[model samples]
Target: MNKKILISLATSAVLISSIYADTTSLGEITVTTATKTEKSIDGVTASVVVVTQEEIEKTGASTLDKILEKIPSINAQYARFPHPSSKSKASISLRGVGANGTLILIDGKRLSGETESPYEMTRITASMIERIEIVKGSMSTLYGSDAIGGVINIITKKIDKNETTIDIKYGSNGDGEAKNKNVNFITRAKVGTFKYKIYGNINDTTPYSISKSYSQVATNPSTGSAITTDAQHGVTGVSNVTYRDESTTKTIGTRFENDFSDNLKVGIDVNYFKENREGEYIGTAKYINSGTPILVKNTPVSSEDKNSRLDVSLDLEYFITEKLSLDTNIYRSYYKKRNYTNPINFTGPTNTKFSANVTIDGIESNLKYELNDLNFITSGIEYRKEKRESSAINPDPSSSEFITKVVKYKALFIQDEIVLNDTLNATIGARYDNISNADNKTTFQAGLVQKLGENTSLRANYAQGYRAPDIAELYVVSPSYKDGKRFGAEVIYGPKTTAYDLKPEESQTFELSLSNKYNDLSSQLTLFNTTVKDKIELVSYNDGTAAKYYTSENLDEVVIKGIEASFSYIFNDSFDLSLDATYLKTKDKSTGNELMYTPNISASIGANYQITKEFSSNLNFRYIGKQFTNSTNTTKANNYNLVDLGARYNINKHLQFYAGIDNIFDKKIEEELGTNVGRYFYTGIRVSF
Candidate 1:
């Protein structure tokens, strides 16, 4: 079916569902990401999803990515285990945009470091989270960059009392075919006005393959006899590739804070995460005469990588007057990573290593003033500096290059909230940013909220977004050297351009939404459209020779239009049901074709039933629709559906046991754009005090 028809159907569904609801107020949860302050999500003029601790606990999902996949209009690559290549790493996409367009923060701080932001979600554990807030649409008026699609802010748990929690889980694929294990320990303590929180995690898993073929044998044309060659005879068969990769991970994190006074506070956060992956290269050396593929070398490869992040911040607030207050924030972060690859060939073994170090420091001050009973004002200024160093990058087997780069940014923003009367509210905000060696840009936003009744509200907003290129995209130097032969070295650095000035990614977004909250039911409907210009993309062209050179440039203009609907109903206090769905229509303006890697339809439905005071059950259904894999829309990804079932038994207040089967139907997992895990069963026990 065409996307237009699908869009119309989705719109009809949203309008149809909104007709029935009671007159009630919204929930009491306050979201800080929408306006950089504590404000109820119902009053905000943008689309946001808040996942509470209670909601997360009921899902029984081990990883953050697995649970986030249930949210409407959110897409991510789903893999049971981390893969060996960069492409296999987990990444989040909003609407139909790629990972680069969205920004991710941990505890209101940048967790992305020098790497791609979306992939960094792997380092966070859902067990340590208090809540997560996801805001959709352009937010450049508040945050400086990469707020085109939206932002995801993860708020970790804080220590208020003394407590310890331990959880253990074991899982297997399809009747104990492959085994996986996880263990986690979390603790929090309070001493006077000082508090501390810490967490530790360990994960290990075995590999699973979709294909059972271990080796390929050659056949004689005339005699029809099978020919087998061993490694000793200079020929080998490739094996151990496909489906999912295997890995082991260990993580440790801690946060320390002191409330010296009501007006001053300080905190520091430290985290160390490490993971190792094992796999065999399954490449064919040549196609033999009899059509059998032969491998000259078969080697098992192992990689170990480490990540560390440290944050120290101080906050001070003082009231100069009864209606005015000043807040100051100073923070600095140091992130480091190291990767080692061991290609252990049966014949020859060699190891490759690379490392990166990045440091960022920033400070901000905000002033809030209540002009009157009807108007409120907020303004802030920030300055940030970043430096990155890399040991070496080997684009080819024979070449390695070292790189170092530094950049600075300054930003100023101001926003006002106006209450004209009891039934109407409006907001206006703007920001200006200056970056080193790039264009200075200004972004703005305006929004309105109109109450339809005691239980319903309609919100409309228009926003402008901006994003500066990341360090890797702007200046990572990968010099390619030809084979060592002549007197001079032939060096090439690409995507590093000096020929033409590159424009930053810019976007304009408009959205209209309606939300209703009743005694037992809550529903939200949002319709949005976004247009992006100067989208940064990797491109290549022939440079007056037979060879092609690559560079990053501002290439295409894209338009993404979509609608999201969410519904939740409580059937008494013991049972509940929730469902959400998204329909997106993204097109490249230059070609009038759907953008690559974007799904047109995706949905999730979940139910929780309490059988008794001691036992409860939860079931979730997910459907991922078809998507185009290539930019030109030449290849299509298969659509898939998954069913997950779990149950929990409480053995008093201090002990509990829960188990679940992910992909219960043994459905074929999607290769890249959908679920990529097999049917797996897991059981776990938790102890807390």
Candidate 2:
């Protein structure tokens, strides 16, 4: 079916359901990420989405990516086998912007490691989270960099009474391949003035081969057409790659808080995570035949990847006076990764190794003052230092050497909130940042919210955002080699030269939204536009050899604009439904082409039905429109649909059971787009005390 038809059907369903719906308001929910202060959803001018603990449990998702992909205007991509050479990691992007444009936080603090790395999200399990707040649009006025797209803040749970919970789950594909197991536990207790929480989790998955369900498709040189074949050798598109890698992930964390009188409170948090993966693939090898080099296909290659992270933080809250208060956070994070590849019969080295280590330290303080009944002011200062040591570009294989880089930055920001009247509110903010080895930057933002009626409100916002060049883009001196598929050819990437004179990418964003809640129906519509300049892009040159050399360079401008709509209706006490859709258009002015991977249309519909007080079920459907995979727009990934169903049964307050199936129709897309691990079934049990 066409995208228009599907969208129309979804809209009709929402409208039809609203006619007979009867429910109560969701009540006031406060969010802190939008303004760095507690504000109700209706009061925040930005486009925001909040996933509560109840909603999180209903999804039956074990990882962060699964939960985020269902959100409107958010695009998520996953890799079956993550590898350093491939530079492929599971990622989530806001609007049509890339993953690097988004900022992720845990309890308002940035995660440790490469700012662009999405692996950090994978380490966060669903069991420990109490809620998630997603604020869309340019946020650089409050956050200095990497906030052009938006920000996601994860809030952990806090218990007032002593409690302990344990959960276990297992899942596998219908064909009995790619099995997975997960176990997690959380315990919390409260004393007279102190509170603590402890949690741990372990997850493992077994690898499987794609050949079981897919066949190799090679291009016919004579006719320029694609042909499916079963040949094991001399083929361009080998289907012998591992569909999923054998992997194991572990996590442990603890939180402690103390209240010393009504004026002061202190808290400490510590978290640790570790992951390991192993996989094998059939690739190519070079051999000498009759004094000529011959490329042989179907060569066996093995790889191993390992990653670990540690985080420690201290938080302080104090009230200097009744109208003034101060909040502070001090944090340190460490991350490391190591990868090894061994090709059985290759021409060069027998083994290749790559490793990276990152350390970050940061401190931030904020003070809020109520100048008068209608005016409020907030100001903050932040300082951060990051250091990275990596052998990613060390050209030598036998020598264990690495290149180290350090970055330090300081920032100051202030914001004012003004209430013009009972029906209108306004906010303005600005920030200035100074970096050690980069140009200084300053950003500004303004927003206004006006009530149209008792049940409707209108909001408008404007902001400026920027992103600084990372260490590898500015300081790498050596070359790194990787064999990959690009533009339908087996290509090799040589060294990526550094560009010391690269400037920061800058953007301007404008947004307008209308929201309304009437009876049992709630709806919202938003329009947004973003224009970016001095964009940093990797430009490649094909040397006479088979290698493509690259350099980071400032490119021309690009523009992205989109429309988003969402509706929810409660049919009765036992049934509720939601529908959302997004339409996007992006263009690179220099090339007059749409941005790669930016789909024009995407939508979702979800419904929940409570069969009884002890049993509940949910069904969800997702659709993604066709998208281009290359800058030239020659290759495309066709549209696909997904359906998921889950149910929960509560035997008592202390014990519960849940089961679910994902990709019920077994929809599959091109391998280049992402892995579609066919139909999967999972069941789990939870016990609480």
Best by TM-score: 2
Q: What is candidate 1's lDDT per residue for 181-295, written digit by digit as tens? A: 8789899999987889899988776766443233332323222233455332233444444333466677888888887776656677777666665544332122233344322
For candidate 2, the per-residue lDDT at 533 reads 90
TM-score of each: 0.85, 0.88
Model 2 residue 103 distance off true place after TM-score fit, in angstroms? 1.1
Prediction-by-prediction clash tally: 0, 0
For lDDT, the strongest prediction is 2
The Cα error of candidate 1 at residue 592, in Å, is: 1.7
| lDDT (C-alpha, whole model) for all candidates | 0.68, 0.74
Q: On residues 546-607, what C-alpha lDDT tens digit does candidate 2 reach at each position?
A: 33434556668989888787888889999999988888888889988887777778888999
Candidate 1 colliding pairs: none
How good is model 2 by TM-score?
A: 0.88
